[model samples]
Target: MAAPAAKQQGFYDCRDAWARTIEELAENDPRIVAVVNDSVGSSKLGGFQKKFPDRLVNVGIAEQNMVGVGAGLANGGRIPFVSAASCFLTGRALEQVKADIAYAGFNVKLVGQSSGVAYGELGPTHHSIEDFAWLRPLSNIKVVVPADSWETAEAVKWAAAYEGPVYIRLSRMPVPDLVVENRKFQPGKAETVRKGDDVTIIACGTMVHLAVQAAVELEAEGISARVLNMATISPLDEAAISAAASETGAIVTVEEANIHGGLGGAVAEHTSANLPVPIERMGFPGFVPTGSVEWLFDHFGLTATGIARSARKAIGRKRG
Candidate 1:
């Protein structure tokens, strides 16, 4: 497991990383095309548009049609990266996502921008807290939630090179870099961020950095907590989860979305079948009230302090 490095640099919005990666890939592969629902600025595709204006296809205000067009482009031998606000991208065009992309097995990279409560103030309608839950159950679709900018760039690269369907969740929220440079993105493998024995904390997306911080805090209290970055939610790293359950005796799962059918639920499903242990799932409990991302995290105990607290509670339960 990699130890958390000293706070490096300032916060960076992951969309920047996604944009840079897309442009780089486009430069190398002409087959790379971007399809968006009129979200050029929001998806951070202005530079890509400038470099390859002909490659950028904007299907204004029609998410369903936009996804359908992306699938069509894929059928025509072009690698279509469909980018849009996550809420509308997954919710409004779910049928198309299932039929045209996942079921049809098209090589389409679905980029859900501003995912989770990144658009917190935009109300629940805009909050993409259900994307993981929605996409996890589908077949032939890789569900990826990158932790930070570095992982975001790596994930985009993986999506481009790999064939078939993929959904890479990105955030507009700024976050410090978590994964180091040169670390390759391996699907269905959980990266161990911290190693310990008292308890294990498995987290995805925005919660990964917080889980690392929580493990750091747990170290001070003499409660060693193992932190696993479960970026791939669907084809979960069940081996790591089983190891954690057997070795640690307690596990705490975290995510930015609902606990039901999200990262937590995935972990629970695996552990229950293989190694049953005390598990506490942390996420938004119900309908999220409107507020800033910080407020929403606090409201639902999604912060590092909150994760550490859950870890302690899980540890106590194991002993009990």
Candidate 2:
């Protein structure tokens, strides 16, 4: 393992981008509407509420009803973005999400705000580590986890335009913007942030920048680690995974959610079936202890240094 890179200078909460992008889209599209479970402030939709008071629907702490209402709104030919905390939105209203939105094949954009451990000290009940697992099996729902502010905005814009069920996972955790040349938001396609041959680190959401930093640290030690931003968990880019597995021969999957049925599990399932490779999945094992967001990240080895360590282990497991 190599030393972590210098501390990031500035960090951005992707929720801001989500809010701004949706508001901009709403300005031109009259059908655009927002449905929340009293999370206008938390979802960073205060400005949006002020701009389109009538367009903002507050269901008052009813996650199930909120999702049902979003489905109804969609049936009425309105593009309703159902926003709420990831935990309650997915856990509380999973049936609605499965039947009303996904199974029904409604044109509703489900914006899961404060996803993963963004709720931090609020404990496991509030932590949304199982959201990916809950939604991934719902084949009709396209699950997207944006890596940064730019990606966040792009995913929102794309979801609004695409007519179908989509889940845009956003985090309150701050992260630096990735420095990818000619960056474009092509959902379900892995964006190569750094090219390497020794090992590949596939990550999404807040873990993407950390994975890039890990690749830099690995580079210092003559370890070429490829970093891929796998923003879309569902409808995964199988081609990228196959290339990384066959070319690199080793892989380390990192995500803010649980390893099972999340990004890591998705990758492992694909590779194990198509192309076998040594893989190390980095994420919460199960329910985590109470702590701040930063502490939890470090404790769970979700940091750049930890990711680099995992990458080395994966490389060591590679067989000739």
TM-score, per-candidate, Cα-based:
0.95, 0.97
| Per-residue alpha-carbon lDDT of candidate 1 for residues 152-251, written as tens digits (9 for 90 to 100) | 9999999999999999999877788775445677887998888889999999888889999999999999999999989898787889999999999999
The CA lDDT at 31 in model 1 is 100
In candidate 1, how many Å is residue 210 off? 0.9
**Model 1: lDDT of residue 213:** 92
Question: lDDT for model 2, on a 0 to 1 scale?
Answer: 0.93
lDDT of 2 by residue, 1-320 (tens): 01222345688888989988998999999999999998998888999999999999999999999999999999999999999999999999999999999999999999998889887888899999999999999999999999999999999999999989999999888889999999999987999999999999999999999999999899999999999999999999999999999999999999999998999999999999999999999999899998888889999999999999999999999887
Q: Could you say which candidate leads in lDDT?
A: 2
Error of 2 at 177 (Å): 0.6
Error of 1 at 269 (Å): 1.0
TM-score leader: 2
Q: What's the residue-level lDDT of 279 in candidate 2? A: 98
Question: Model 2 — TM-score against the truth?
Answer: 0.97
Query: Which pairs of residues collide in candidate 1?
Result: none
